[model samples]
Target: MLIFFKERLALLSVPKTGSTAYFKSLRDRADIVVSGPPDLKHAPVRRFDRFFQNIFLKMYDTELEVMAVVREPLDWLGSWYRYRSRPELLGHEKATHDLSFDAFVQGYLRTPRPAFADVGSQSEFFRTRSNGRGATHVFRYDNQQAILDFLQDRLDTEINLTRENVSPKRPMDIAPQTERRFRKIHAAEFDLYDRAR
Candidate 1:
């Protein structure tokens, strides 16, 4: 999808989703490289319309299979905390300053501020079909291997992926507080995410 817009293929990165490592290894393989060794703070995926158009349609639309990897909401939040909190890794002055796992979860609940794409829910992003080419696939981070195989078939490349964005923070099984916050903040996304779960 991003490739259609910039005329180059790029890995639409999402925060704390092991995308950093995934992109690092795949950077050279990708035709239009958005992920690089230098490490960009606000990469292209950080933009709102990451997948602006699909060249096939010659319209400003996202392409099908413009999928994203979604983690268990709570686990996702925990991993995000580890990534952003590490100022050195993320190269942010205060990436995690004054930010708590609970607070961030609350924020996501309040507004599922997707680092990439416009809407929240994974289904929303995928369901949103565009005459111009929109995302059609969504891979769960828990099932990355299958997603990678799918991508391999699509891109016609042998991808040997390694490295992950694992955080030391213990996973919180029941995020009641987080759930409550999301219920209020990301009402629609919460509904969708729950339904999917």
Candidate 2:
């Protein structure tokens, strides 16, 4: 679901945050079609880059609207850690190599990797070479319905959004201290989020 969002609505799948649910709804609605490259697992980045160049931007040139959703980084990191560290999601080999959340966060900062490394970032999906820079619209994951409404207007089509693939169990709550750390860790993102408020 981490496809670029341009002509075809790319759901920059930011790991958790109900992305599975959103993708399922889009699948059922058939508002648009979805496809991935044949060598998805081995060369995912190349797949995405090629898709953007060959498909997404090409579609945009023809006047198609593109869109996606993003979650707050703290929430995104929490879900990502759980997904990567939890026993069920990984095999013994991968599980044994797990890094602590704090360590992972540090590594993420040191490396030139994509934000979240699950879903593409605001910069990745939206930015254009000509300098419009990242997207016509970005919907906060917390306010998906508003985004859907905006999409409905842009697409000139009715979309009755619904959910699917929700986890039966609740996620561990984000603690006050963790929330504060997250705000500090992603100060720029926090500032932008606040300004948008």
Candidate 3:
């Protein structure tokens, strides 16, 4: 997460949504950059509200408007699948080296997902709290220009981003039937991505 106190903005790092590049580009300008300890780095809306929000409210006397980026559902899963397939994860319990894309996605749809397909849901990540605290701005992963424009205008500085933590390129075709099931099971994810600008 990257916080700009002056701008009253907190950019939530939604996993696999090109947040690493944004972090790299904006770290110096951000007042608080949480880029370590994966759990903290990827803190979802509920987590942030429960842990960090009150601290900022009490100490900084500021209510930061959160921002997040969400990728298309299938693409997001594909990124996770490809990422886990990396050679470095070959021996890991979460490795996807032995699974096909279809199998991986199917596993993801399971009630108790197998380790290799346990990537968290984007919709869940940005879910609004009961008090209505959630991301005020949401961007689509495919729309880098919109993200850049918003950041530049909001931050009052030109922004340049270098790609970082990109997953390996691979053909990610899911079986049509399996995809139908996935879509049904993960409708919220698609809805969230569609709603994003």
RMSD of every prediction: 6.3, 5.9, 1.1
Superior by TM-score: candidate 1 or candidate 3 = 3
Between candidates 1 and 3, the one scoring higher on lDDT is 3
Ranking by lDDT: 3, 1, 2
- The stretch of ten residues in a row with the least summed lDDT in candidate 2 is 38-47
The positional error of residue 126 in candidate 2, measured at the CA in angstroms, is 4.7
Candidate 2: Cα lDDT at 156: 53
In candidate 1, which residue ranges exceed 4 Å CA deviation? 1-11, 36-65, 87-100, 107-133, 164-175, 190-197
Quote the lDDT for 66 in model 2: 35
Task: Give the per-residue lDDT digits (tens) of candidate 3, residues 1-197.
Answer: 99898998989999999999989989999999898899999999888887778788889787888898999999999999999988899889999888889999999989898889988899899886797588889999999999999999999999888978878777787899999998998899999988999
Which candidate has the highest lDDT of all?
Answer: 3
Q: Pick the candidate with the highest TM-score.
A: 3
lDDT of each: 0.49, 0.48, 0.90
RMSD of 1: 6.3
Give per-candidate clash totals: 10, 3, 0
Looking at model 3, report the run of 10 residues with the lowest lDDT sum.
163-172
Please, what are the lDDT tens digits per residue for candidate 1 over residues 1-197? Answer: 12422333334554545666666666665545454332332232223234333332346343423445555555655665555555464545435445566655655544435342112344343344333243244456677777678667766767777776555453344358667765565555444345431
